[model samples]
Structures are given as C-alpha cells and as structure tokens.
Target chain A: MTTWDGAAAAERVAIISDQDVVRVRQLVRTLAVAVKLSLVDQTKIVTAASELARNTLVYGGGGNAEVSRVDNGRKPGIRIVFADEGPGIPDLDLALTDGYTTGGGMGLGLSGARRLVDEFEIDTEVGKGTTISVTKWCR
Target chain B: MERVPVLKIGDILLVSIQIDMEDQVALQLQEDLADKIVVTGCHGVIIDISALDIVDSFVGRTLATIASVSKVLDADTVVVGMRPAVAITLVELGLSLPGIRTALNVELGMKLLAQEREQYELDLEDEDEEPAVSTR
Candidate 1:
C-alpha cells in the first residue's frame, strides 16, 4: 500500500528523554523539508512528531522513532514510525478519544497527532508493546 | 537544564524564548516566572515565541498555565509572535488556548498590558473614592 525510497533514506532517533522529543521534532522538520512539503505541512508533521515522541518516552518508557521518505505513486511523502517495548495501551479507543488521558497531560497527544497527519496507524498489545506510524504527503 | 531568561522592562517582564524548549525547560520557565513576578512585582508579562518552530500540546499547556499563574499573582500575561504555521497546527490540534491573551508582536502585547494597567489603576481609584457607611 505504501512504499519508501530505501532503507538508506531512513533515520532513527532514540526517544529516551525530554531532549529526545526536541530531537524528534528537528528530525521530522528536516525530512519534511527535504521532501518539499509546504511550510504549514512541515510545521504540522513536526508538531505531530513531537507529541508522538513524548508519548513514547512518558507512556512507552522509551522507544525509537524511524523517519523516512515515502512514495504513493502520486507524490512523495514523509513517514515516521514510533516503536516502543513498554506497557502497551490497554484501551485503544479510549486512548484515541480526545480529553482522555491516564497521564496528567491535556489528553490531546494521540488524538491531536492523528489529526495533524494524513495517515495514522497504531499497533499495540497489552503488556507487549506499541507502534504508531504516521505519514504526511506533499501537497 | 538550560534556562530562558526573563528580562524586566519597567513594570513588565519580557521573555523571548530563543531555544527549542525541552519539557524540563518549559517547567523551569514557569517556576521562574512565578518567582520573578513576586520579586519584581511586575504588572505584565510578555512571552515571545516567534523563534519556536512548533508549539505542541505540552508547550501550549505550559503557556496556559503560565498565564493562569501570572493572573493569580495579579499580573497580566500576553503571548506574542506565534508563527502562522504554528497557529494553524495549534488550531488543528484542538488547543484553543482559552484564558490566555495573545498578540501579533511584542509591541502590540506591550500596548495591551499598558492599557490593562491603566484600567486597573482607574478601578482602584474608583474604589478609593467610594464612601464607606458603617453601622455602629
């Protein structure tokens, strides 16, 4: 359904601390700009990456984020995958709902991140792990 | 942790964020602002964020908290210089930042604070002019 440019085009950043969240935003911005996304689109993806990256650290107990260029035959896009081996989300539906959060956050991280990107996919298993992938296509 | 400097200009505190703020840094700024408000007894705070690339939920929430804290300390807070792209993304993320005042730039923000200070002084004067009637 989706294709990437190559393995070499991907960059991985560790999401272990608060500083890592800032790193994630920077990485996403660089990749988004390289793909020639609009300025607004670049901001959107960077913000979404920051949210997801923080989720990985605070909720997932640390993780890794992979950023790469994607292609869907029509145009080039940016795709980011955040993978974590910590406790997975028990309630996917509740987690996706706005204003619902186990953490003390505003509960807008997951839902807001989803809204900022064009494609969002989540894979999780209770007590196992969680992986969230999002893509933003150039317009 | 790196700290954001808060400069005092007259009765207003100015903070121009010039770094990619981490969570700890944001929290530190909040605490620092509260302390500075008490020590300096400033009437207004203007936070400049034009240099920030993105304002996520964490940053947005922090700004709102700072505004509330400043209000409780009897000071008005005005966030200024949000990039157009950041504003669009913030709206899309469903963070309207209610109860927090915003301005296009520092000059406008300063103007707003000055007007608020004037109105506050007028209200105090009116209260002082009120005749007190106490029943013995």
Candidate 2:
C-alpha cells in the first residue's frame, strides 16, 4: 500500500491481479463520466488506464492506482497515478521506447499509453519501485 | 476463467466482446473462436467491440490475431463498432491492425463480409475457367 495524496484522488483501487486490469478500466470509466470527458477522451484515457494497469500487473508485479479530479488553474482534468513496489525498472529510456518490452508484449503499453494522455510522468528506482502519473483534460 | 460466448448465425460466427477481458480470458476466447470457426464451418466472423470502451494493447493484439487466424481458416473477419476513440488510440499505439477489416457496425460488417465472399467466389470461378482454357 503506497501512500499518495488522496486529496487529489477521488477514488483509488488496487492492481494486483490480471482481472484487476479490467476493474481499473471500469474505475476509469466511472471517473471519466464523473468528469464529463467527451466520449473520445473517455475512451482514450480508459484505454490508457488499461495499458498502465496491465503494466502494473505484468511488469511492476502488481500495484495500485488513484483517480482524481484535478485543476491546473487553466482547465479541469482527471489525473491517474499508478504506483507499484515490484522489481523496479533499471532502464527508463528502454522502457519508454516503442516496441521495447521486458515482458512479451508488443511494447506498446508504455509509449502507446503515453500518447493517449495530456500529461505523463514517470519516477522509478533500480531496487525500490516505479510510479507513473498522467492526466487527461476535458476539452 | 470467463469465456466470451460465441454465437453462430447461419454460417457466420458472432463474437461480441461485451466485458473487459482478462489476459487468460482473451487467450481463451481466441482458442474458442478458432474451434468455433472450424466446428461451424463459418465463412465469416464479425467481432463487435462496441461494448469495449477501452482496448489496451493486449486486447488490440488479441483482435488482430483473431482476424489473421480466421483468415488462415478461410473465413473473413470484420471487426465492427469500433469507437472513434479506440481507433485513434490504436493508431497512436502503433497497432494498425493491418490486413484486418473494420466497419462501423455489425450490419455494415456483414455487408463487407458478403462482398468479400462474392469476390472470392468470382475469383475462384475465373481461375476454374482459366485452367480449362490453358489445358485446351
């Protein structure tokens, strides 16, 4: 259980299993509607959530996520934070590259998920863990 | 292990992915689809993903694989009801789903399959006649 600023997140969930991927997608849908994101934005962010959730389970070896309604003084947005304490990534550049995978995926999870969001952030340690946070603003 | 139901309509297989699939379930659905296509001798497969709001890489690859697998089995696959957002995300994700056909809805998907089938039969007939002429 990683500690996060719950003040930012209106809801949170765990991502410890394969099925949790689906649950996280569902949770994203809920937040998407709550934030009244357009249908396209909703799908994009939800799809992003699906990718990150799978990464949390498969690569990060299970983690947790938080969804929050955020404002940057310009527009309202929904922020997603995925944190995990699994075997931390040793190489951030390789991990972010398209078609790069330690796991047997197409290597689109990280790069692809990045394209679908408005803002993306990544923090990782060699032995500790990784934390990824993203935002999708309502247009 | 949740299995997506495969419904047979005439000689066509209808697979609607209504729920977000686990990895196991997605793989299972792929296997089951292959079996169903063979068992039913389906000439066409229409996969409806309208209910799928979010298509991650896994799901996207599963769909692409399903399309190619059905083609190898001599069946046409038409993915239907792809939301605009899903399509945009797939392209950005570098999943073009090449060689896989898509339509706006099931009705249009069925139409595409029918057109493909007709063209295939026409090509077959043309080949048959060409062999006769060459042999003569």
Candidate 3:
C-alpha cells in the first residue's frame, strides 16, 4: 500500500473491489462538502473518482482506490489512487492516446481521469499490476 | 483507506458525477461516443448526478453527446438526480443539451425510452407505406 501523509486536513480511504467505487465516491462527496470545493472543482473530483473506479472495474480486473485529502498550503484538495494486480498496461503511451480503446467505445478512462484532477500520475508493469494517482486542488 | 464500489445494472451505466466537471474530460466523452448512439436498438443510458454541485459546459457537452449517441445506437439517454445548484450553474454557464432526453429518476428514463422506441417504429411504418419518389 502506498501511503501518503499530508496536512491534518487529509482523510484516507481505500477501495478494494468494484463494490468499493460507490463507497469511495460517497466518501469523496462528504469530503467535498467539508472542504466546499468550487462548483468546477467539485465536479472535477467527483467525475474523476467515478472514472477511476470504472477503470478499476474494467481494466484493473477489480482493485482498490484510496481517497484522501491533500492540503497544498494554498488550498485543500482531494487525492485518489487506483491500484490493480491485473494485466498491467502493456503500452502506457498507446493507452493514454485518445480513440485507442480496447474496450467499448473510445478510450477515455485514463485521459478523462487526468483531466479531472489538478495532478495525475500512473505506474504500471506488464503482467504485474498498475497504479493511478490523482490529486485535485481547489482553485 | 477504503475501496470504491461500483454496480452495473445491464447497460444503464450508472455513475455518480463530481460537483465540478472538467472541460477535457467532457470533450473526450463527446468524441468517444460520437458515432455510437442508435435510438432504435439500445436500452438507454442513466447518468447519476446526485453528488455534483455544479455543471459546466464540458459536462453539458458530454451529457449531450451521451444523448446524441444513444440516438445513433437506437438508445435513449437520461440524466438522473441533478442537484438544484448544479442546474442553476449549468444554466448560468449557458450550457444546454442537444437532441437528448432527461429524467429525475432511472424508472422515468426507461419509460421514456420505451415510448420513444414505439414512436420511432410507428414513424418507420408510416414512411414505409408512403410512395417512394425516384429521381430517375
């Protein structure tokens, strides 16, 4: 488990399976309310969490997503990490590219998740697993 | 630390959106589903916005695409449980959906789709009965 300890404002939560997406989303909702993220920031985080959890279900072969609060000195933010032991991305570059979906419709999971966060990162190994980290700070 | 849970009920595609939706994500959804909606073949789409506090042009665009794509896929699209504040924000942003249907709940959306399908079939029948005009 990659653990992060930031300001006291941070609250950490974990998602272990597809069933956890709703739980994680609900936690984020409460935190968003507590922090009072701007309309745009709130939407961004909520959508980001939803997309990331969807990724966990579709690509991760079911994994865990951890949610927490990040205080960036200037503003408070939300963070999410989606990790899976399923077949790791064989081609990270290609996976991030738009219109390159192996699943239904176009591939927007990773890219869309990136867009919803103030900061985003991904770590993966083929045949091993993958982890996606996202942070959204209020403007 | 906890895991997020998700439940998929057929092709309904239920998701709890964030309060603030981003521009790039919205555009991605629009482009991704641009050629996929069909109004006569699909069951319908349900987007849950109960967690959201605001809606932006990007989100509005994505939702609109879902609606448009559902038509192309012969499916119907509906946005469920929108917050009042978010609605006002969308209106203020001048965000509007095109060629899409919406409902306050999932049941209503399904019903709407059923009605639309019946109407579409009737329209098709009417067209079939009309005399064909040949350019030749």
Most DockQ-accurate candidate: 1
Q: Could you give the C-alpha RMSD of every candidate to the true structure, in order shown? A: 5.3, 4.4, 10.5
Candidate 1 recovers a fraction of native contacts equal to: 0.96
Poorly placed runs, candidate 1 (over 4 Å): A1-8, B127-136
Q: Pick by TM-score: which candidate is best? A: 1
Kept native contacts, as fractions per model, are: 0.96, 0.83, 0.04
lDDT of 1: 0.93
Docking class of 2: medium
Q: Where is model 3 more than 4 Å wrong at Cα? A: A1-17, B1-136
lDDT of each: 0.93, 0.86, 0.63
lDDT of 1 by residue, A76-128 (tens): 99999999999999999999999899889999999999999999999999898
Residue pairs that clash (backbone atoms under 3 angstroms), model 2: none
The parts of candidate 2 lying over 4 Å away from their true place are A1-9, B126-136
The ten-residue window of minimal lDDT in model 1 chain B covers: B127-136
lDDT of 3: 0.63
lDDT of 1 by residue, B1-136 (tens): 8999999999999999999999999999999999999999998999999999899999999999999999999999999999999999999999999999999999999999988987787666657675434334
RMSD to the native, candidate 2?
Answer: 4.4
lDDT of 3 by residue, A1-139 (tens): 2333445544444555534665666667777766668766676676667667767767778777777777867887777788889799998989887546676633666775675677889999988999889887777
lDDT of 3 by residue, B1-136 (tens): 2211223456444445543433444555454443323222236556676775544333555677667765666556678777765555444333445565677776776677667766776667657576534436
lDDT per residue for candidate 2 within B1-136, as digits (tens), equals: 7789999998789999887788899999999999999998999999999987767788878888999999899999999998887888778777887778999999999999988987787677866465433322
